[model samples]
Target: MANVYLKEAIRTMETSSGTAANYEYASTSCQGWRNTQEDVHLILPNFDSDTSLFAVFDGHNGIEVAAYVAKYLPEYIRQNRKYKRGRVSEGLKEAFCLLDGQLLLVDAVNELRAIRRQAHPELPEYKPGITSGCTAVVCLLKKDTFYCASIGDTRCVLCRNGKAFPLSIDNKPDDANECARIMKAGGEVVHGRINKLINVSRAFGDHMFKMVPNMSTIEQMIIPLPDVIIEPYIESTDSFMVLMCDGIWNSMDNSEVIDFVGSRIQKKMPLAKITEEVIKNVLPKEMPPSGIKGKDNMTICVIKFKGKRGGVGSTNMSAMPRTTVRGNNGPNKHH
Candidate 1:
């Protein structure tokens, strides 16, 4: 039975600045044999001064958690006191933890249910036992620096000088640290799943996995804490960054994606077009033994940086107007 809530969708957003660093980004979500489209994204060009934020959220069980993060993570980070004080790393960590905490609140859960009901009235009502969650990978470009934060399987990778450099690590249940933590918290890892249910050991809003008697938040079977990476962005050497869900990674490795995108960029293809091609490459042509073809919602975000240098100057200039294009929920192309 095909999931009625699942559909193929594409969204593109782009911005170019004559003064600061310019960026081009696009995202595509294909049901691709899945029952639901649980992937969501965020693209905020020149979010503040010289900073830009991009992220991919891959939801499991339900889309509410992913949608909530896509809607609020950036705002939470920007409003953080640490971010205002120029502490990007601290600010991001604080923001991720805070957002996870907020998801457990009664008001937050109610709001998510309301939004889901409004978006998909055909779906069943939200119940107390319903447990949903999402994985997040975020890239924040501030001045000449880049910050990457991730939890769960979604990943952020940088392509520099035609080579792939991972910005975030995949948090899986089989990892030694994750397994140790889960065991200590009275949770068992069975077949690479936390309690034989969730695969990723760190994510946002898996309330069931997070509920451990007398255990601290960090000691839960699955924690919302993210692994963050900070690096200097070299305009001359760095090419672009790829943020994607596990669906892409499950089919293609990091190097393969980088090479594919690099080859397309060499042909002078638009960033949005490159993203479309990537999605197509991962989408399965025929249904296989797994019952579904692709079996996952593939979402990709490509951020192509302008080769210009220099941070936002003293002149307070407004950002370029963002243009968004959405494609129909079918195998269609939109420029």
Candidate 2:
């Protein structure tokens, strides 16, 4: 098994609306089959006890872009005015777009430009920009809502009562509708990947190679725009979630993870240890995927709503009964 390092972990108590909103969260990053790449995540305690969390920052070129998002994106929300009102989701969307625009605002594309500029101002590559890029799958949980948004393949899955539900859809080059839109706008979808380069058509970086016509700026060059999904809680404490990067999904499917996690929770196992075991069990013993070419980075964060006061019988996670739902459960494997 690979020796994984979970960069950060925390569980904080929350209070909202003059009342206590109990919450517990834990996260870790693993070097999934790749040595150079590192995954990053954070649970930002922001805005009146709401939880803002993200995972699967798949970095390309260098880890700078992903690292930047992990460290600073949450700060934007805390500082942005719009987020203070009821428009937190919209604020986050604009923040992402603005971040890309700000990247292209500078004059250089090297990762170490800032450091170099400070150290030796005469260096040409010391300009104030970098070409690095990263994808983000973020979730903001407030009250009983799960507000989710994504830029790439890193996904969010919600599970309740032993069933799998998708919380976000991956944005890929081959998405037929997206492909048609790109082609109509004179963009090419080559070899199942947009412009025959990045597998994910929309992401936070790669301003150097995006759509043309100077099309809607470099950011929109890869844009159908990011997606935002908000859903009511499933209401069953037995329900849990798996937020992961592509590596875990590549080797296993929704059913596999849901079954594993569900079975463990049913056996009264802690989500924290179960998450760690999932990574340890999946990683091979002899040849860890790390350092191997073509192996993507891996990371996973799971959240389970625990009952209040006493235990399971108190406030289990049962979806406030729904009507006209598509799957057996709400949003199962569809997000």
Candidate 3:
């Protein structure tokens, strides 16, 4: 087994809540059984007058990449030409690829080390290169629609009249499409993991796997491409949505999670409590040494849509993007 597990789990949580034009949201994160807390999230309840953005970055190897993405991704997305032209979906995909490319440069690598320095002054072993990476799952609310962009195992689920609808596909090496890409790049998938190292097929950072001698970034063994999904909103039928990392999914299925959160909503439980409670209920009592599904970092973002009677059609899965602005990444507040 890997040597990243700690003797004890960290239960302390970082929680926040906010409201947007049509929904209210709350997010919670815990370090859990990992050696350190590498997961970080961004909540943009009012990204603009009509748009909102929520994202979770599940970092691997270190927290620097996740932290960097949380703080600067919005700016990069906004700066993209497609985003400026109202092509939110296209902008999101390009922004992800563009940012991953930037992270490989010397300046970007140095900045990542600086972020780590700020978080952990005692652990100064981040050398002059970048090997860390993060799985990003983002939910964008614009008008009466939802656009989700994701890479890796982090997921977004829509609850429609107590039913569950997955918005994004989990990119894994074992999946046929992902497997083909890896094999085309001359990389081997051993035991479901990429080169017996990372499990997810795509993510930010991780320049080591991405550096193929003469291949373009997208043609590398591991790329930064994201699968985007577009879902039309039906306020009458859709109740809420959940965006979380593999930590929560490892313990519960899509239906189980919708039911758990739905029942709590019926009782008028606060959104923040529901988020924290899910983590508390799903966290393993005794994490296994392998740390596959159990005892990993956990993060959950709950967005509840306000009822308005008559509604619309089913959720759609497609490629997408969103608008710009700074977000509330603080505690007890979301604006």
Tens-digit lDDT string for candidate 1 (186-207) = 8899989888888998888887
lDDT of each: 0.75, 0.58, 0.79
- Model 2, TM vs. native: 0.73
Ranking the candidates on lDDT from highest down gives: 3, 1, 2
**Model 3 root-mean-square deviation:** 7.1
Predicted candidate 1, C-alpha RMSD: 9.7
> How far does residue 334 in candidate 3 sit from its true spot (Å)?
34
Instruction: Supply every candidate's count of residue pairs whose N, Cα or C atoms clash at under 3 angstroms.
Output: 0, 21, 5
Off by over 4 Å in 2: 1-21, 45-47, 107-131, 184-186, 211-214, 217-219, 286-294, 309-335
Tell me how far the alpha carbon of residue 22 in candidate 1 is from the true structure, in angstroms, after superposition: 2.3
Q: Runs in model 3 with CA error above 4 Å?
A: 121-129, 289-291, 308-335
Which pairs clash in the backbone of model 3? Answer: 88-321, 89-320, 89-321, 228-318, 229-318
Residue 257 miss distance in model 1 (angstroms) = 0.5
